[model samples]
Target: MPLPVPDRLCDLPYAHLLTPHTGPLRSDERYDTVHFDGGEYTDQRAGGATFLECAFTGVALSGVKLRQARFNEVWAQAGRWVGCDLSESEWQDSAVTGGVLAGVSAHGSALRRTVFRGCKLEAVNLRAAVLRDVVFEDCLLRDVDFGDARLTDVSFPGTTLEEVRLRGARLSRADLRGAVSLGLPDGHQGLQGAVISSTQLLELAPQFAHALGITVKD
Candidate 1:
């Protein structure tokens, strides 16, 4: 059986079912236990809106801005967020699956125990974010920036990362055993407790040597 996708907020009985708002979303609105399905939003601004225990299914968001939004225990599946601004958002214990997120800016965000599975995230900016116990499984991450981020117990299994920037990122006990095409930026101090395969270690040998100030002679 396949994993169930998020379609409705079953926990909330009296919640509002929002059809696509057409224009920009109201700022600082608290949408608790709201459910959205197959809706389309373009160039909308939902900054500072609070989403608690919400569910979004097959929603299409284009150029939507959710900057400083708060999502607590939210679930999103089969959603497409293109060129969206999610900077400084806070997501806690949420799950996102089968989503396509392109050019999403999440700078200075805080994500704790969030899971992103089977998602394609391109050019996502996570600079200076605080991610704890986050997991990225079976995802394609291209040009994702993690600069100055704090990652604790973050796992990336079966994930392919391309041009990922980890400069000044602080990793404590991160798991990267199943990551592919991984390369750290100039400073490597961020990968202290990261778990990598032997092949990956061999591939990064030269960079490791350079970081250690060791000259290898054949």
Candidate 2:
């Protein structure tokens, strides 16, 4: 299954038409219709900023602080956001393609209509976050934490979730049917509102039985 392209790209402005964004980002500053191309920003702080209709291509962001930042109609591709502090941020109508986001602190964040395609997300902290209509297609999610999170209409198609933590997470219409691998370290209790395939359920029967204290003696 393929991921849907972001609608924001339909009205993408040309490079010359886009404003080049450089220098340090200020808090509460609103950036609209801007482009960040091949920029390397590390350890920068940009909390409480709002970005609308922006594009980030080949950008490298490491150890950056972007707490409470809002992203709308954003297209990010071929970017590396490692060790970023994105906690409490709000992302809407954004698409991240072929990006590598590792060791990100996105706890308590809210993401709506966001799609991650062909991206690698490792050790992302999404605890207590709220996600709606989010999809991970052809992506890799390893060591991701979803503790106390609320997910609605979230699906993982052609994605692998390895060593994910989901303790106390709430799911509604979360489709794991298309996942290549679903490795939930916190067990089935955290999958109460999720929808899985029959094959997946059979594979997890042992864990379910153990959770119920039902000893199955072969």
Candidate 3:
């Protein structure tokens, strides 16, 4: 099984003035094609909000809670997000590049046709999320949780996955050849159609044997 090539991101223009952040954000509001460049947002809560064709460049978000939000065709580059909660959010056709996301929780989110490149993800929780046609390249993911997530056509190249939890997560045509420290726990049964190198297979032999209920002989 091979990975599906995702569509290229389109450039969206900013047509509105820069709205200064002051208090709590509105829910179910449409942020129509706004551009956030070099902006800093703090303590904003935008649950169930929609961001269509928006671009976020060099933006910094701290203490933001966007639970169940929707981001369609958004491009976020060179941004930093700390302590943000995006649980159950829907991010479709989005590209997040060169970003540092620390302590962000996106548990049960849906990420379709998304690309996350050259980013540092620390303590990010994506448990039970739906990930389809996602590419995570050259990213450093530490303590990230992908438990029970459905991954289809997902590839992780040149990425460091340390302490990542992938229990019961399905993989369809996922390429992890260049990933480092990718240790699957014992009895992991969702590695079908996953591509890895010989070295990785050898390193994961113990877990594989355990999954097969095989006992090593002395």
Candidate 4:
């Protein structure tokens, strides 16, 4: 049986009714665990709801408020979340591959074991958030703030961190291979416990030597 598509929030009595197990739904209704494949959610308010095992591929969620919500094992591939507020939410074991998150506010949220591969995260605010075991591979992170956030076992391979703020953030055991950064005070200040290529070190050696007032005379 094909699931009913939601058209409006008023059509459903509650958000849970839009789930696959329940009856059909309108096209504009808010839902939980609703198979929203290839759909767009614009200017919706679904705060404090839990979406378990939901798949949202090639979807757009703009101007949405998902505060204090939980998204467990959710797969959102090729999705776009612009100007969405996901503060204080928990996204556990979720995979968001090939997505775009622009101006998304996830302040004080928790992202555990979440994988964000090949995504574009521009001006995304993750201030004071807790991120554990999160991997962001081949992503473009511009003007992203991680100030005072807790980061454990985070990896960013082949990613661009241009003007990305990581001040006062704990990056112990974080891998940053092939990451390019500008506007950083020094390479050592921004790269703590991060893996770097030998070529990168050789390129940065002159800068490090200049900072230490040591002259390399050959």
RMSD (Cα, Å) of model 4: 8.0
TM-score of each prediction? 0.86, 0.94, 0.83, 0.76
User: All models: lDDT?
Assistant: 0.82, 0.89, 0.80, 0.73
Q: Encode model 1's per-residue lDDT on 10-104: one tens digit a residue.
A: 53333354433333466788877667778898998889999887788899999988999999877888999999989999998788989999989
Which of candidates 1 and 3 is the stronger one according to TM-score? 1
Looking at model 2, report the run of 10 residues with the lowest lDDT sum.
Answer: 1-10
For model 1, the superposed segments whose C-alpha errors exceed 4 Å read 1-24, 185-189, 213-217
**In what order do the candidates fall by TM-score, top score first?**
2, 1, 3, 4
What is candidate 3's lDDT per residue for 72-149, written digit by digit as tens? Answer: 877788899999999999998888989999999999999988889899999998989998888888899888888888
Clash pairs (backbone) in predicted model 3: none
What lDDT is reached at residue 13 by model 4?
31
Name the regions of candidate 3 deviating beyond 4 angstroms: 1-25, 185-189, 210-218
Off by over 4 Å in 4: 1-33, 180-190, 202-218
Against the true structure, whose lDDT is highest? 2
The deviation in Å at residue 74 for candidate 2 is 0.5
**Could you tell me the TM-score of candidate 2?**
0.94
Residue 204 accuracy (lDDT) in model 1: 84
Superposition error at 71 for model 3 (Å): 1.0
- By lDDT: ranked, best first: 2, 1, 3, 4
Better of 3 and 4 by lDDT: 3
Better of 2 and 3 by TM-score: 2
